[model samples]
Target: MLYPATKVTLIAEHFLVERVCALIEACGGHGYTLTPVGGKGLHHLHATSDRATLVEGFDHQQVEVITTDRAKAERIAERALKELFTNHSGVVYLESIEVCRRERF
Candidate 1:
């Protein structure tokens, strides 16, 4: 069986992942996943390139949360945009998705 849900994607600096997770959990989110990523943004921060190794990866992280409620996901995104994006370098968006085990969410 499939259930509708919202998938929130947040790409932020590595240091801000914790705070992002906290915000999600505080707003009735069940869980999330974090994957370390590296790239150059508008700031041109090439933390990891051919010249650098895994140890040099510290510029970016991708955090994803799957929530059964769309409003909850948007709330988190809005909170992040208002509180974090103004000062911190990050982007947040939401995608519609379907989950197999609805109860797990």
Candidate 2:
């Protein structure tokens, strides 16, 4: 059987993984999937010349949480943006989805 749900996705600096995971759990997300990801965006192009060194590639993480409650999903996304994304390079988005195994979420 398919169950309706919401998927919240957060992509941010690798160092923020722990905090992000904690936030997810605190916001009623029972579980999540984490993966190391790499990409180039405005943050890369705007690197300041003052920095003596530059670290590139795979410096970001992708955190995904699927839950049956849309409010819980929105809460996760909103909190992440307000509490975490300010002054940080990150993005949070939510999508409607269907899960085959509802209990797993």
Candidate 3:
């Protein structure tokens, strides 16, 4: 069986995980997976510079969604950018993927 899949990767401040998931669902993605991340970026410094200890835990969260169609992935990216990108520290990217199972997506 051939599977159609698109990987949507979102890197944003930890607090927006739920909101980004909601945007993914709203754009017709069935589900997603999230992993905690720690990195440096322009926003990371400006926001956490004052808290020396807590800054170590101040990491971005990444959400990945596999969708069955390319359009769905594009929609998810667009909606996320509009709804959450502004005034937030993050980036969203989409990549084409091929898989063996059709139902999983």
Indicate which candidate wins on TM-score.
2
List, residue by residue over 5-98, the lDDT tens digit for candidate 1.
9999999887778888888888888998988776565123433355455446656789899989888889989998887777777877889999
Task: Please give, for residues 1-105, the per-residue lDDT of candidate 3 as tens digits.
Answer: 777688999988877888998898878777889888765562543554445544577467889999878988888888888888877778889888887776777
Q: How do the residues 1-105 of candidate 2 rate in per-residue lDDT, one tens digit apiece?
A: 999999999998877889999999998788999988766552543455543233355668899999999999999999998998876778788999999988888
Candidate 3 lDDT trough over 10 residues, lowest sum:
42-51
Clashing pairs in 1: none
Q: In angstroms, give how far residue 44 of model 3 lies from its true place.
A: 6.5
Model 3 TM-score, all chains together: 0.82
Looking at model 2, residue 25 earns an lDDT score of: 93
lDDT of 1 at 94: 87
Model 2 / residue 77 / CA error / Å: 0.3
